[model samples]
Target: MLATPPDFDVLIVGAGISGIGMAAHLEMMCPNRSYGIVERRADIGGTWDLFKYPGIRSDSDMHTLGFVFEPWKHEKSIADGPAILDYLNRIADERGIRDHIRFGHKVVLADFRPDEARWHVTVELEDGERKLLTANFLYLGSGYYDYDDPYDAGFDFSEFEGQVIHPQFWPEDLDYTGKKVVVVGSGATAVTIVPSMAEKAAHVTMLQRTPTWMFSRPARDAIANFLRKILPEKVAYAITRFKNIRMQDFTFKTARDKPQKVKDALHKRISKTMGNDFDLKDFTPPYNPWEQRLCLVPDDDLFESIKAKKASVVTGHIDKFEAGGVRLKSGELLEANIIVTATGLSLAIAGKIDLRMAGEPVKFDERFYYKGVMFSNLPNLAVVFGYLNASWTLRADINSEFVCRVLNQMEANGSDLATPVLTPEAEAQLEEDDLFDFSSGYIQRGKHIMPKSATAYPWRLNQEYLYDRKVMRKGDILDGVLTFTKAGANAQSPDEQLEAAE
Candidate 1:
């Protein structure tokens, strides 16, 4: 039996940070409009709520990760996962966004009916039932990570007798205490898991295919904390934010200009910290700094654990999984009771949405990206992407603001639909190689799905706050290939008219 169809002004998929932010903005912009956010999980916080692995934390500072309207009150800039999740949950509850979210409701497919000018959304309920919804607009706030499966690198684990766990699918009942744990992969998650598990486990071994460029920074900024005690909260946050931004900017510039110098400096730092115990060459990646990603070690804890003989790093290729352990290509078998695969996430663009326009299929591969906001030839759809250089929320904030402006403009112009259309020549000018060179699955999947821009600043993901403010906030919202379709002409209903006006 088909469940009762609920009609809404807007239907938002994924009740994560982006979805919550979008809901809040939509509510503020059009208070009378009826909207609903659907999430597959029982609660909010998306990835934060999903992952329960030890030592999970934000890669970026708390200030950057947090929403602009709500400042993070925590003293530590680099916060752990539980704290971040709490902050998100608090935001959802405080803003009354929890009511708008329909948990355990996963959107299966969304089809736009041009004649009706509404999106026919199909969702699966928790009770093995299917429900249909119709909305004038559809907004996807699902982040880039693949939530369906934990990243296991094509390893035939059938031969291995040890228990295997992916951090994404971490079991609540499983205990790692006194067990020899082997964490496979070289990334932020692996780096974090090794040190944290070493505290409880008998031994922790971090096996990596290649050494990641690792850098050490204190989890709690002592100077910032001192300043906070003396200065106002806002002032302290500003100072720390500026300091972090400038440091990141300098590092990015150095890596781009003098790659060898950055590598040499990093090599020296790692050697100085580890002395004879750590193998510097084995841990250093051959690629340029930031080519993959620089692993941030909190307070040299990973190294400290290695020095104490509780943890160790092994750099080699895994031949296969043996009965009791991993067999490396170098003919060495490392025994372990448990194996953790921190390989990486499989990227799904717009969370694998099937898009159609005017009853014709729209291939994302043939399309072009407009300022990273709108895809060419797409109508009334905008994808929110964050800055690669700065905090994810910084860019997300601007995107939200820009979306508000566009919405306001549409209302004022009495338009029912707006589509950004790019020229064929302009679209062809984009270079694929320079766009997303990252070897990760997310970047690889985005090659056809995401916008391909060569430059970083202004055109691409320039992390500069001032530049983004000017281009995204101050720039004209309807300047480019935006085609505005007036109401009634596109067969929009009276209800949609009332909703749009609201």
Candidate 2:
């Protein structure tokens, strides 16, 4: 009851890939609505701008990572970080969305007023100035991983440390040149850093407690290149995107359905490339493929490094860190001048902003995701969380489209409030699943802080892109689960939704 009208119609958090895309979507779909973006950094690109480590590239194909509305013109489906950042900035400038972004402004807290159907957002600008702003809708495209907080392997590397570095905070000036480097963990970051750093380092050693599945792919997508040469730009891009998506879908399905067969094929490829002398066990993962994300090596760079002896792989547990380097559980000692902990990212949703509803702190675990975008009992909020199995932007673009649809639907209904609601009994009946079903340590560690996933429709988020494209992008907006209400009243009950549906 203590809430007032909002100044802006919407306020988007983060000015990265998701935020920039969200701005463009709003421009196309909600032209009448006034919105602004607040980014914590002084730059527009988020992750791409943040991670300056060498050899940082897209794990997934860029064709799918690129926004649906905007076609990717480049030949490489998997692009490097700087290229990706440049592409995002180009998008912002071309669309004229760059001006709407207020850099160096971080949203600290957002208090939702159910009565007033508004949000009072607290933002801290550069130079330590805190200010309050209000908006009718809040869209969070801040991304999943936290830049400031990265996951460590709980290594007692506390002692005898020789310039330990995290991929998240890769120092620009720190030189690994002509030094023996040991990169801990076998995730995407480690794999990427191993080869890139080996180019200059005296010798790079990749020490992994457990092996991760790696796929060697060409840096340049041959099929996409052929299509580009033969077909029109737009048509070629559309075809290439579709082909890549289908290929990813097929590969993922094959891995899931026939784990051993897919495993044999993948392991065979690696064993042949790396040669029998380089133990295949180092490339063999205990878990099935696609259980955790697959690591892609462009042009067999990682394998080439290992083959050329520029880099080596050591598979064992770390007993402790000694004076010079790491002591393995197998009684082997790895001597290194520098240690790079390419562990993984710490998941921080909504830029780690506090969400309060009616003066009460909102519990993420207590809330169910609505269509994987909006949280249950949360009004006029959309989150951009992409698919784990496919390209990130595939889901992000659809989520933006869905958010636009929600806004348009509310406008059409003359309703100022829209919230996804479920009966108490129904929510209680739903079974809880991990927000992300992956064996990745970062995801597992952050599960306690993430929102719980449900089993039923409107609550579950399918990882498949085609399914989401059908449901999220083309599904009915008047679904009974999403209740609409105008100002000066409480949200509609289950009976009201049923009656309206009838």
Which candidate number has the best lDDT? 2
lDDT per residue as tens, model 2, 1-502: 3354577788999998889988999999999998999999999888888888889998888888898878788877779998898899898999889888888888999998866778899999888899998889999999998777787667776677588888888899998889999999899989998999999999999999899999887888898898889998888889988998899999999999999988888877787787766578888888999999999888889999988899999999888998789999889999988998887888887778998988899888778888889998888888888888888888889889899999999889777778898788888899876567788888788888777688667897678788878998889988988877765543266345434443
List per-prediction Cα lDDT, in the order shown.
0.75, 0.86
Worst 10 residues of 2 by lDDT: 490-499
Winning candidate number (TM-score):
2
Q: Report the lDDT of model 1 for residue 399.
A: 71
Superposed model 2: Cα runs more than 4 Å off: 1-5, 490-502
For candidate 1, what's the RMSD?
4.3
Model 1: ten consecutive residues of lowest lDDT: 486-495
What's the lDDT for residue 97 in model 2?
A: 92
Task: Itemize residue pairs with steric clashes in candidate 1.
Answer: none
Q: TM-score for every candidate vs. truth? A: 0.89, 0.96
Error of 1 at 439 (Å): 3.5
